[model samples]
Target: MNLYQQAEYWLSAHKIDQLPEDEGIEVAFAGRSNAGKSSAINVITAQRSLARTSKTPGRTQQIIFFKLDESRRLVDLPGYGFAKVPLAVKQHWQKTLERYLQTRRSLRGLILMMDVRHPLTEFDQEMLNWCKLSNMPVHILLTKADKLSRGKGSAALEQVRSELSGEMSVQLFSALKRVGVDEARKRLNEWFQITG
Candidate 1:
């Protein structure tokens, strides 16, 4: 079976203390609320409900883990920059996210999602900066690309690329239309060190 097909249940870490031992490769998905991060994960994994998708933003409040066999895992982090959430909760998540990114030994890469039409909000820039400091690889997914015309989508991709530096990869994706699904899967497989 393919790596994504082999993915199975892994523990959810509500707190840093609940995280699994730092022994395997993990690639995390992060984005602002309503950026379609969960939808992108579902599309990439070819699993409809692997990560819960909701119309409500900021519904994912915990760090959920999915294991592709024993040594490769995918992480779904809490969405940031949602205004409706309480300040204390948001602060807690921010602290936890910072700690995870800075100290997690097995984190090999990150998949940062952004809405195609609204790429690079303040939160997205903050994540890019953090990844830069850690020298961690990031793949930016401009989600909801189907909402735009082909020319517009291509233009958005180019615009975002021109603004970015370093080794980060960026692509236009539409989970609803299955756009860029294969490309996202291939990059994730490479990051997870999974062989076909």
Candidate 2:
């Protein structure tokens, strides 16, 4: 299926306390600030503005939810590891993210976007830790693949694989170039089918 064409805006929850009832499959998108999480969502949904893109860091503070044909939900979580953001806000996101990662059974998987230039930051490691503890399947997308040459992308991918000790799948992606979009979509679509 063409995932982009099937997505629709469903809901946005600022706090975990306000999240809707656990309904269908939820695949969360997370990464450090400026990691292209929002842009990736926009590309996957084929909606230019469905997920807000920002040059500034720490703008997305909510766990936004978008429905995919009523069978699965794509979540855009706030960017973590914004050193300039207030400590309170960081703490809040951390608590919420950790809790959601640890407890949400409906969360079928996680799409962890990372800038190819800086594949795995300390915060990325922490997020991986949470995924490990939860035993959640994760897919790491090295965003901005177009920024690097083909050889560079391959080397970066290898670097990340060697550095991260986990079971998550990895792919090099470029939202601008539409690279790896199909692979990411296929994985998410499979979760939708399983949940449906």
Best lDDT among the predictions, by candidate number:
1
Q: List the residue pairs that clash in candidate 1.
A: none
Q: What stretches of model 1 exceed 4 Å from their correct place?
A: none
Q: Write the per-residue lDDT of candidate 2 for residues 93-153, one digit (tens) a residue.
A: 8889777777777888899999998888898898788778868788899999999999999
Q: Write the per-residue lDDT of candidate 1 for residues 120-151, one digit (tens) a residue.
A: 99999989998888799999999999999999
RMSD, every candidate, angstroms: 1.0, 2.1
Per-candidate Cα lDDT values, in order, are: 0.89, 0.85
TM-score of candidate 2 to 2 decimals: 0.92
Candidate 1 lDDT (Cα, 0 to 1): 0.89
TM-score (C-alpha, index-matched) for candidate 1: 0.97
**Candidate 1: residue 94 Cα off by (Å):** 0.4
